[model samples]
Target: MSKISVTELNKISREIRQDILDMVYTAQSGHIGGSFSSTEIVTALYFSEMRHLDPADPKRADRDRFVLSKGHACPVWYASLCKLGYFEKYHLSSLRKINSILQGHPDMKSTPGIDCTTGSLGHGCAAATGMALEGLMAKDGRRVYSILGDGELNEGVVWETAMAAAKFKLDNLVFFVDKNNLQMDGTSDQIMPLFSIEDKFASFGWNVLTIDGHNMDQILESLKVARNTKGKPTCIVAETVKGKGVSFMEDVRNWHGKAPSKEEFESAMAELTA
Candidate 1:
């Protein structure tokens, strides 16, 4: 696959955001804030960073793997996959419907490109760690990538996985902490004050980098650095605005899991289209 320029990548991110707002509004249930927040991160991977992904041969060995550790933000993932031709665009509308492959969280069995089933807060990162270790043990050069919400760090299991990834020196694993600073309830500080996510990962013995999550240049550069890093795993703390690209939803806690009303949806779509 050819490399995508930063300009093109930004266009794709905006399209994904549109898909997210449309999915949530149509379903009247989904996590929109975090999905919007992490849109660029997911876009960078699927469109620019990761490699060896075939829409037809999603299960091909030696292909890179990605896990949405913050599973509720899966509308972004579904949009990315659909855009990449992992499945038909029609499935995007079926999001969260009963028996739809595009469920509230990812299901590996039903989804063609999903490498893991995830929705339980800290479980996805743990599963990603295991996948990285498996690739390591097999001596395959495959790399595993995952995205974690900053609030998900409150989970003890997340820290546990951090320790294990470091202990094994799983440099093949690279995860991003979506430091959007907001969660379902309120601001992350109001909920569980994660003082310094970068320092936390560094203390866990991982190579750490912080970047503007919405900046395509920064996001692509961090992934390059992570790939070149050796010895320990890399954690990129991506500072982002919740409900990014949408004027009304940005940084608003209420938008975390709420579907936009008809007027709100139209407004969001108009903003994204612009």
Candidate 2:
């Protein structure tokens, strides 16, 4: 991974946001707000960190891996992978189309860089824990990174995985919670009140870090700290907005899984380009 300046990461983020908008608009059916919220975190992981897999050999055992536990937000991950040369940029427009590799949820068999097939919200964390444990058993330096939505934490499986992660002592795995504070129904608090996610993870016996999810420097530094942790998994609570960049989408639940209208798409693209 190249050392990227904050200015450069900011520029890259805009391109990713454009990809998110374009793909969702083209598919006419896909999650929009969550993808936007997660763009920077996915961009930072794929472009500025992670290593050891060529597009041709994404399934290699020694490669660093990433799982989109919040599978519905894969547009951001797909966009980042394309930008990182995992596949041609043109494939991004095929998102959610019939028989497209870019399915509504991530499928590792269909997509080259995806390491796991994840759509059921809380399952990715458990799968990620297993992958990280495999690396530990092999004594491989490879790390596993999994991104989870704050809303997804409402599932019991998330805490089960948290406990298992601590029990296994998976120092090589890093978990990121996209703490956007909203689920499909309403705000997270109204839904289930995950009052202090950071504290909850801390109680699980893992090292925890919190950061502004959109701040490239903080994202980078937290990953650095996580990389250096020993004997316990690390959890990063990334504070984020549901819809990060575009004016109309930010914090708006109506846009959760709705594609922007043609006019809205045009305005979004124009704003991002500016």
State which candidate has the highest TM-score: 1
lDDT of 2 by residue, 1-274 (tens): 6677878888999999999899999989888889888888888888778887578777777888899999999998888888878899889989988888899999888887889999998999889999999999998788999999999998999999999999999999999999988888899899988989889999999999999998988999999999889989999999999888999889998888998888999998999999
Taking all chains together, the TM-score of candidate 2 against the true structure is: 0.97
What lDDT tens digits, residue by residue, belong to model 1 across residues 1-274?
4688999999999999999999999899999999999999999999887878898888888888999999999999999999889999998889889999999999999888999999999999999999999999998789999999999999999999999999999999999999999988888999999998888899999999999999999999999999999999999999999999998899999999999989998888999998
lDDT assessment of candidate 2 = 0.90
What TM-scores do the predictions have? 0.98, 0.97
Clashes of each: 0, 0
Scored by Cα lDDT, where does model 1 land?
0.93
